[model samples]
Target chain A: MIKSKLPKAFLLCVFTLSIFIVPSLFAAGTQEDSSGNPYAGKELSILVSAGWMDSRYDETIARFEETYNVSVDLQTVPADQYGDILQTRLLTGECADVFWIQSNPFAIESVIVDYEDFCIDFSGSAWESVVPEARLLSCKVGDSLYGLQLWHNSPEYVMVYNKSMFTEMGLEIPTTYAELKDVSAALYAQGITPWFIPGADGWQHQLAFFQIGGIYEANHPGLYEGLNNNTATFKDNQTMLKVLSQMKELSDLGYLGEDWIGSNSTNMANMFGDRKIAMAMANSSYIQQIKDETGTTDEFGLFLLPLADNSFFPTNPAGPTMFGFKGTENEDLVRLFFDFVCETESLQEILDNSPAYTNIHVNDDAVQQHWLAEEKAFVDSITPDQMVTPVLQTGTKYTNDYWMDFGADMMSYFIGRIDANDVLGRMDANRAKSAKIAQDPAW
Target chain B: MNKRTVYPVWFVILPLVFYVVFFLMPSIMGIFYSFTDWNVRNRGDLSFVGFQNYIDIFTSEENYASGIYNTLKFTIVSNIVKLIPALFLAMLLQRGLRGKNVYRTILYLPAILPFLIIGLIFKSVLNYQDGILNVGLELVHLGFLKQKWLSDPEVVWKTIYMVDAWRGIGYVMTIFLAGLNAIPDSFYEASEIDGANFFHKFIHITLPMLSGTIMINLVFGITYGLKVFDIIYVLTNGGPGRTTEVLTTYVYKLYSSGQYGMAVALNTILFVITMAAGVLIVRGMSRKEVEL
Candidate 1:
């Protein structure tokens, strides 16, 4: 009788202990996590394009997760498909806490056109000052800030060429389109691709035409204003026509590459190291990348792309900008993330982790920058007048959104399927379509 | 027909309700949306724009008309390219070929592989500079024959067709193999006794008996052809330029650009095409059945 009674008592004690212990254990965990933080158990989701926020931000994000005891869901979409996917997610009202865009000054007004409805208004946030003054145009639609631009203020998409190769070949950096053609011819004679324009990259090839917006503005004064005011169009623009013809001429000569349209820039550094190519359209920082990646002792330098006699610097203040999705359940958490990313420690971490960029463009005084001397030299060489005009795509309204479309049109023109005029005409029509959608009075 | 072969009305009622609510209603709504100025911007309310969207598709300088042309061309050509080879392969394997099962498995392997994987592989294989095909050609004495397979406007469509055929032929052939197996060996044996050669037997016996299977393939091929997107998208992305852009790709672009009205219009055009093709195909099959 004692033994049977003991067994029943043991069972009852075990069940009662479990009931008391389990609840307390959960309560302890909850208290521990939520003790010092209001957003301890919340989640922050970021939707970004593939290359925008890579593994460089992983550690920073992890730190944020640990400090706040929160989880971050990072959804990186492939660059080619990001636009469609973002649009789909936004349209379906299922967008993440944060989303990113390849933003320009006109982007907030043009791309995320319904910015007031879509983005969280961070007008008076302390983090707004961390962003550089030049970058605010891309980040702000007006006095209201919607995006955080974390990008380098270095020369972007300039002609990064092998200085050693050009010197060895007895060639000067061509300042005119005709001289550029001659340089290409001389390189092609030696069984080398003179200009490595990776057409397969989808958006790389159009840089030759659009990066020279200053030249276009110089030739056709107030062209940017004309374009924005709807008093002008890309169609039948003689300067644009001349530039297209020169690009076609290069294509016809096979100086761009044996098959630029079929190839990507995956092995570009290796190609540079091997001295198989003389030059390419790349950022000033790509010089350092070539040295680090391929150990190429061959010195590389930057030049203005000599397409259509472009002597101007591509003064682009645009880059990948992140915005808070207004529809998020964790609005405070989203705001916290924007603030967290702007902190000096986080800024330093991002710059240290980013191998592609030599310097961070933020206005923080504490963070040390590793700016290349090559960049300084290139900037010094360009005249003050030359740097006045922005790149063609960003200067005009609603142009950057049609980047991929224009690239496709350029590809067609290069392959002999369509004339140059048709490409220009399509851009005009596409811009008009954007204007119609925006309900812009300028149209 | 006996009542035993027929199920109760209530048996189908649940499935019918599910179809109407989930599939039929959404499709009808999509059609309705196509006639309006509904887009990403105007999510709150919608306004009717009639056939203006449809008119814009043909008239717009975006050259959506060419996309329609490419879609139709791809449909006809891709079917021809797949069906004939699949049929022949099925016939060859149906005979007493040694190691037939091994061959069948190997051939059907590609069919099981997803299109995304196939596209990535082919893009590498067809790259003009460092691709295996061009390199192999150069390794041999056939370097002169090498062309910019994907970049050349002339060859881009051909490359797309080739890749599509590679992925699809096995599936087509598998269906043909099953149909061939269903055919009685007695038909061929009887024909052989009557001095019918292989060609004669194929023309008289095989063609006549395979009519039902042929119709099945045609119906499937036509439908698949009309909705073709993945192959074109993965391979060239409707480029070297928009030379390979199809209606679906265009629809996707327009939709992504937030021109939902235009996108829906393109889709509606595709819907009309598919419906018309379906009607013609069904009528043709019915007439053939009556004749038989």
Candidate 2:
């Protein structure tokens, strides 16, 4: 009887120990991955326009996935369709874990419309200091940070031209509208399309007018302020009229391109590689892209867009910015992702992978920059006063929201359907409409 | 036909409730919103402005009136382009033609594709500089025939029509094919016996018999044309200087830009136009039927 009791007791003790100790032992191993994170095995999704985040973020996200044991769904939308799609998703309360907006100082309030309800409050996050001071305005509303703008500070949307081609043709860089027309005529005579404007893109063609905001400001010192305050209008401004006339003249002469009105930037690099085109309104970083994509031996350089005789650097402090969705289920993961991207290693990795960009403009000094020599020379060439004013679309209130409409109007002007004054008058009307919508008392 | 099989008036109550809640209520609310200060900034709270939205549509510098005009033009032109050719194609495929099934499938394939896919394909084909259409024209020594298919304002509308017809003719033909199949052989044979040629048979027998099909096609075509967005959007996006700017494109732009009142007013105009056209056609067809 004693031996039988002993065997039963021994079996009972073994079963009892297995129940408690086995799970604890298993957890000890699993804890390495979970790290007490409830969000483990969950999915985090990001919605962004195509050019905003490409394969540059892929490796970083992969590393993040490995670290968190979580999956990341990166959705890249076409630039033209992204605004509508994002707004639709946002209004439907179906936005992804993280989403991006082409943000400027006023974009968060005007574009997002209700940033408080939508964007996560990352005011005190570890990544706050990494954002440069100039970008802070775009990332925050009343000092409560809502976005992370991880973008390059390259001269945005300036004329990128083939230096080799210009040298071969004995053409000097144009510094005025008259010189631009002459150069364009020269290039057109050589059977090379000059000043290639992808007007069909519905976005690119307007840069020649908007990127030289400093020129506008210089001509009329109080124009940006007046526009913001609803005290001024884009209508019949002589400088603008001159610029519009220049663009129309280019379009009329076919110097922009044979089919520039229906062209896109898809084959632009190849166009440069083949020396079929001379220059285009593109980011300074595009010079590297042209070399990388087409394996072109020809050197490229940047020049101020000479439309309206403007010499200002396109000092746009706006960029494609990422925001954590306030309604996201994986909030912790979103926070972690933001933190991960801002780290020194990740920043360096992003800069290294982005062949289109030269540097990541952040406050972190640890990350090495890869600024191109041409870009550096271009930067050095600019006077301190040249960078004083932001680009027109971002500097003025509610302007960027009507970007497509303005582009269309510009198209209308280009094709002679509407005159220059009509284009400017329409912009005034649109701004008034948005001002009314925003309930701005100034309107 | 059978009274006993018919559901009672009270039986519709459940579905009526759903229809009112899901469809009717929202539509009425939308119409109400059209007159108000509704916009993206103030979604919940709005004030009635009473025809101001409509006034803006008619008078705005953006030329909303042109959008309506374009919509109307498209409705008339697109139908004329599609229906006549589709009727002939249907008649051709309905009868003893070699490889009828293969031909039918080949024609029907485009109709099944989504507008997005069709738009992308057409956009690539219609690209001005290096598109296959121009490249092919050059290769075959017909280079001068290659026009700026999408860019030139004079050609953009024609290009849109061409693309619209390509995708739509197949579907329209299919409907006509069904109508043709429904027509008994005895009528054609009887007409043949009476020394009627193909045109005579078609006019006297086929057309009168297929009046219902024609009416159905007309209504479908008109509505599709009025609400056309995707094709124009993908190809030109109301470009070549708003030459292709239709009502729906204007509405989309306004709506997306937080001008909901304007968007809805534009929509209301579309709604009225569609309904008015629908009523006129239906009434006309009914009178025709009575006359016949």
lDDT string for model 1 (A279-310, tens) is 99988988988898888789889999888888
Chain B TM-score list for all models:
0.96, 0.95
Docking class of 1: medium
Error of 1 at A411 (Å): 1.1
Clashes of each: 0, 0
State the local distance difference test value for candidate 1: 0.89
Report the Cα lDDT for candidate 2. Answer: 0.89
Question: Per-residue lDDT of B1-292 in model 1, one digit per residue for the tens?
Answer: 6656766789989999999999899888888888998776676678999999999999987789999999999999999999999999999998899998888888889988888899989999998988999999999989998989998999889999898898888889998998988989999999899999989988998888888888899899989999998888888888988999999999988988899888988998999999999999999999999999
User: Candidate 2 lDDT, tens digit per residue, B171-239?
Assistant: 999999999999999999988998999889989999998888888899999989989999998888788
lDDT for each residue of candidate 2 in A174-260, tens digit (9 for 90 to 100): 999999999999999999999898877778887888998899999998999999998888997999999999888888898999889
Positional deviation of residue B139's Cα in model 2 after best superposition, in angstroms: 1.3
